[model samples]
Target: MTTSSSPLTHFDGQGQAHMVDVAAKAATHRIAVAQGRIVMMPVTLALILAGNAKKGDVLGVARIAAIMAAKKTSDLIPLCHPLALTRVAIEFVASPEDSAGVASLIDGETGHVSCTATVETVGPTGVEMEALTAVNIALLTIYDMCKAVDRGMTITEVKLLEKHGGKSGSFVNP
Candidate 1:
């Protein structure tokens, strides 16, 4: 929350989660990167690669969905503060996509299509939730588009990869 001692920012002394008061805090350049992936059959991956999925452009649509979702993070989650994000970049990767890790092509049966959202804003609060929401929405979009062909698609590795700015300064996940 406030980078104070309290472990949770969304709650009060009574522990009921509330929107933390960010009005008093100084606005800073804050950024958060969130990432996740959808694991599917090799055929599903081929369809995405070939742009032959019945759902139209899979990664293209998912990218837009993620950015839109990040911007609407506050509305989607009750406790989140609606933030004016400066940038929301959704990068899609096909695996064995090692680098940024949006998608992967590890084994024969599983193919990963990962989405990473980088959210930036000059605000008092962090964009971690927004980033996370973006990643989730992106992965969900992928699942929805391909469900007819691959109902077994699993969303995994959804997390805030890192955050910068604000009182916390910086955090890199290990």
Candidate 2:
């Protein structure tokens, strides 16, 4: 297990959270992927699928929100270094079951919606936080647009799936 004093290179001497000093680190291409899920009622899912959510196109707005969030990561997250994002992608996949929010795009059943955000950058620091923020904002946008139909919607499974670049090399969830 990684310890607090493992010479991780990002720690402050006092052990309090501190931004990593990347002054000497070489600039490199970096990418990070994050995923999350939102669950809601079948009718709510139908409304979303049919583009009848009343709040306009849910996916279109959510995608824009995610991209904006990725670019404004430092503004939203304190202490996060502002880095130029090379690219960002956020997409939603509806579940395929009647009891779920959306079973399939072709079927009328309601199942869950899965969201994934990938962030890429060529910088000293990684884009993990940007990717995560994009996923979160997308999920939040989904909630905001659909709350009128399903107040009990649940957002879950927000997690980092993979990371590439930086001194640590690469990482992927086992």
Question: Which candidate leads the pack in TM-score?
Answer: 1
Top candidate, metric lDDT? 2
- Across 4-84, the per-residue lDDT of candidate 2 in tens digits comes to 664755566656668778899999999999999998877777788778989999989999999999999999988899999
Q: List candidate 2 segments past 4 Å from native.
A: 1-11, 97-110
Model 2, position 7, has a per-residue lDDT of 79
lDDT per residue for candidate 1 within 39-138, as digits (tens), equals: 8898788788778889899989998999899989889999999888899999987875446533345456588878888999998999999999999999
TM per candidate: 0.89, 0.87
